[model samples]
Target chain A: MRFFRQVWVVAAKDLRAEFRTKEAINASFAFALVILLMFSFAFDLPVETTREISGGLLWIVFAFAGTLVLNRSFARELPNDCLDALIAAPISGAALFLGKALANYVLVLAVELVSLPVFSIFNNVSVTAQFWELMLVLALGTWGLTVIGTIFSALTVNIRLREVMLPMLTYPILVPALMGAMQLTSALVAGKPIGADNEAWLKMLIGFDVVYTAVSLVLVETVLVG
Target chain B: MINKILYVLGIAALAILVWNIYTIARLPEETRQGEVFKIIFFHVPMAITAMICAAVSLVASVLFLLTRNFKFDALAVAVTEVGLAFLAGNLITGSIWGREIWGIWWAWDARLTSALVCWLLYAGYLMLRRAIEEPTQRATFAAVFSIFAFIDVPIVIFSIKWWRTQHPQPVFWAGGSFPPDWTTHFLWNMLAMALLGAVMMSVRLRQEEAQRELDSLRRMAHAL
Candidate 1:
């Protein structure tokens, strides 16, 4: 109960602050939109090639923009020494990590809500089939993203060139999530029914989500104190 | 005494490796692999070398985390740097082999993809060390991040391999079959690579100690 409260307190604080500035939300949306616009001209291929890779392009945009959200998540904490103040409080380190990750997840998902529709429109790929499953994939993918993003963001908080460093560190480990989500998204775009055939990839996403989240919970405290 | 023994072994290993090259040259080559097949002898041994170094670094990182000993941190850093060299060797040879065999400069095959990712993880780990200025705090972060980065190895392998098979493509990714004798021949080269890694790591550790000495001396000079 107290743990939950601690988590909520951090999340609530971040959310209240984010609600005021909405900085991450705006930047993430704009980034995704720019990528969508580029997708039209960047690929010299015809419609079929573009269609095949559209899901991948969207996820790439989201992944790239999510970095902005993560960098600012801690970057903002630096100015007023907000992270030190939070640590100085009695809140557990795990709670603080969860709160930050959850806040980033929400920000990524909010960007996704707008980007998905825009992606569908831009690419002319109808996603009416397996809409619910697509959402599930989005949730899991974004969760996986935030889990690593939060931990690495914290790990890199004091580093020089953190903005460049975060994506280099993250995109590598994002293999499972990126692979699983791209596969599922391509299928969803193709209007294939989501069924047991996709079990392994789905399990891949869940397995990574579980392992990364658990490890982050344990290590986030270690990363914070330094 | 240990350093002397390591140097002797390293020199002896180099001699044996020079001899192994003769045997490798005499052995008949595969039709498809042709001359590029020779790259595997270098490729496989160095790949093993990098893996061994990464494992050693991971152990040292854990020791640092447990004991908070700077020595373990130094060992970890040395091993990781040596590992990076071998990893770079592995990537270069693998890509060269890929272009010759796969007709492409790169392939999305599991082994290649995982190795690339593994390289990134450790590169990021090293950058992480540079990010923190305080020695103790940098050690703590490195220890934690090493563990985190190491965990990605198996998962990257598993996921990329599965992702490859699940969705079949036109890519020429069928594994190359080396003769059974090749595995036996790999032992000498593997030993040589390990010896090479050890020599480099020893040199790195010596440099680290010298730097530590310099840092303490500077502090002492300041105090006076």
Candidate 2:
């Protein structure tokens, strides 16, 4: 219980800080919005095709902008040397990682909330009917990303050109999980028959989330101490 | 003595290469798709040997992480170097073979795509090592990254395979059916390449040790 509290405290610290500045939320949201608008311009495809492709495009924007968000994730701690302070504290590295990831998920999910609606408007599709189902996919997908991204951000936090290194270090490993997200989103967008098919994808997302989170929690300590 | 073994391995691997060339070059007139099929022997061996390299690196990385031993890191660096080289050869040869059979330079076949992902993962691993300067920390990070990357391999294969079945069908199968003699050739070539890969790993490990020794000597002289 105390361990969970410690994790929540770490996340609360981030959320409190982020709520004050809204730096990650505002930047990532705008970046995703612009990318969505650009795709709207460059594509010029018909509405049916646009709707079909929009799922992928939506995730791509989120992904590209996510690099920026995750880059600054640890950076927010660096100006005040908060990261080092956190490392010095008696907090479990895994708990710290989970807390940070939780904060990031909240922030990225906020970004998604802002832009996904705009994406629907620009592409002339209504997500209202499938919004809850879509959100479930988004939540699972974002969970996977945040858990992995937090660890990688820590890995590259002290390195030179880490902003670049973070993405290169991140995206390859994220592919399998991201692939799950893309497929499920596609099915949701296309309004396909979804009982077994989407279930499998959801299962994959859960599996990836379970597997990576478990392993990364164990490994995060090594990256954190340094 | 080890150097002599490496020499034998290198020579034997080369001999297999020559024998492969001879067999393909001397195929009978009525043989179907005669010379084009030759690429498979090299392609399969390189891919399998590349996998061996990756597996070795993963194990070494794990050992380094647990033991915090620089020696394991050295072996890891050697294996990664050799593995990445073999993987590059595999990708190129596999693509050419794909071209021969599928008439395109690339196809998003599950196996090929996962191999590409594996290559990217290792490439990133090397880059991660270069970016971190501290000796012990670098090894730790590299080891953790290798483990993370290896865990991803199965997920990649699974996700991509599932995606293939869930999505549109495009005849993504790229390799042609193989003959019995070709399988024999493949096994021999793979054995030879694996032997050479092991040799390269040991040689690189020795070089790493030498360089570390030299580095320590330089530090001592500087201290003086």
Candidate 3:
């Protein structure tokens, strides 16, 4: 109970900070929107082709813009020496990590939510029937991204060239999650029936999220302190 | 004494490598693949050797985290660097094989994609090591990242395999009609490559230690 409370407190703190400035959320959403807009020009295909690849394009946008939010998550802690203060606080490192990851999840999911309708409208892909299934994939995929992005964000925050390092470290580890997410999203977007085939990817997404979340929670202390 | 051992090991590796190359060149062509199949002599051994290096590095990373000792960190980096090189070799050889056999420079086969992704993962690992200036912090961060990276490997393999796999099933040891001597030849090549990898690891580990010593000396001088 106490641990959960601590996690919420840490998460709420990040949320409050983000909302006050709105820098990360606004920038991320705009970046995502811009990427979506630009991808239309680059591909400039008929509706069929656009619908075929939009799942991959959406993930690409999420991935690129999500990095912006994750990078800011820890970088913000540096200016005020808030990271050290956070460490000195009574909270456990796991709580701190989970909190940041939770905050990132909410932020990235919000960007995805706003971007999805725009994506559907722009691409002419009707997702009405698959809306709920798409949401399930979106939530799972975003969690996987945040758990990894948040941890790698913390890992690279103190390193030189962190802007470059964060994505480099985060993306390759993200390949499975990204692959699973892209596959499921594309299937749902194509209006394919959800079946055992999709189950494997869902399982992969859940497994990827669980394994990394547990591992990150355990190792966040070593990463932050030692 | 260790240098002497390494010297002998290097000599043995060279002698075995020469013999292996000679034998590989003279070996009979596969009934189906003919000459192009010969690449597997170099390809399979390096692939196996790189996998061993990856396993060793993962163990070293875990050990470093547990012991908080820099030696394991050094071992992890050394093995990963050597492993990366071997993996690169394996990929190149496989590409050459594919170009001739599959008639494409590359295929999106599960094994091929996973290997490429694995290469990128370790490349990222080395890049992470370079970005950190403090020795202990560098090692700690690298080790933690390595553990995470290593854990991702199976999921990578599984995910790709689940998605789609067109890479031909293993015929090397699956009681394929290759003559009995083929196993012997493969084992000898494996031994040669393993020894070469060990020697390279020894040299890299020593370099890492010397570099650490130099770093500490510089820090002390700055302090004074």
Query: Looking at model 1 chain B, which ten-residue stretch has the lowest summed lDDT?
Result: B164-173
Give lDDT: candidate 1, residue A2. Answer: 94
Would you list the C-alpha lDDT of every candidate in the order shown?
A: 0.81, 0.80, 0.88
The candidate scoring highest on lDDT is 3
Question: How much is B208 displaced in model 2, in angstroms?
Answer: 2.1
Please, what are the lDDT tens digits per residue for candidate 3 over residues B86-149?
Answer: 9999999989888888899898765787788889999999998889988889999998888888
Model 1 stretches astray by more than 4 angstroms? A44-47, A194-198, B1-3, B156-182
* CAPRI tier for the interface of model 1: medium
- Expressed as tens digits, the lDDT of each residue in B1-224 for candidate 1 is 96787788778878888988888888887786687778778887787788888888889988887788888988999999999899999889878887887777787755676787888889888887887778888898888888877876665445445654321232223563656677667777888788889888988988887887898899899999
Clashes of each: 0, 0, 0
Which residue pairs show collisions in model 3? none
- For A1-226, candidate 2 gives per-residue lDDT tens digits of 9889999999999999989998887888888988988998998888788767766887788788777777777888998788899998998998898898888888888888888889889888776656678888899888888888888998888887788898898888887678778877877887764477567768878998999899989989888884
iRMSD, all candidates:
1.7, 1.5, 1.0
Q: What ordering of candidates by lDDT runs from best to worst?
A: 3, 1, 2
Angstrom error at residue A58, model 2: 0.9
Q: Per-residue lDDT of A1-226 in model 3, one digit per residue for the tens?
A: 9999999999999999999999999999999999999987777788777767867998999999999999999999998799999988988999999999999999999999998889888878776658899899899999999999998999998989999999998898888789888988888888875798778878888998999999999899999888
In candidate 2, list every pair of residues with a backbone clash. none
Measured with C-alpha atoms, the lDDT of residue B39 in candidate 1 is: 77
TM-scores of chain A across the candidates, in order, are 0.95, 0.95, 0.98
Output the worst ten-in-a-row residue range by lDDT, candidate 1 chain A. A43-52
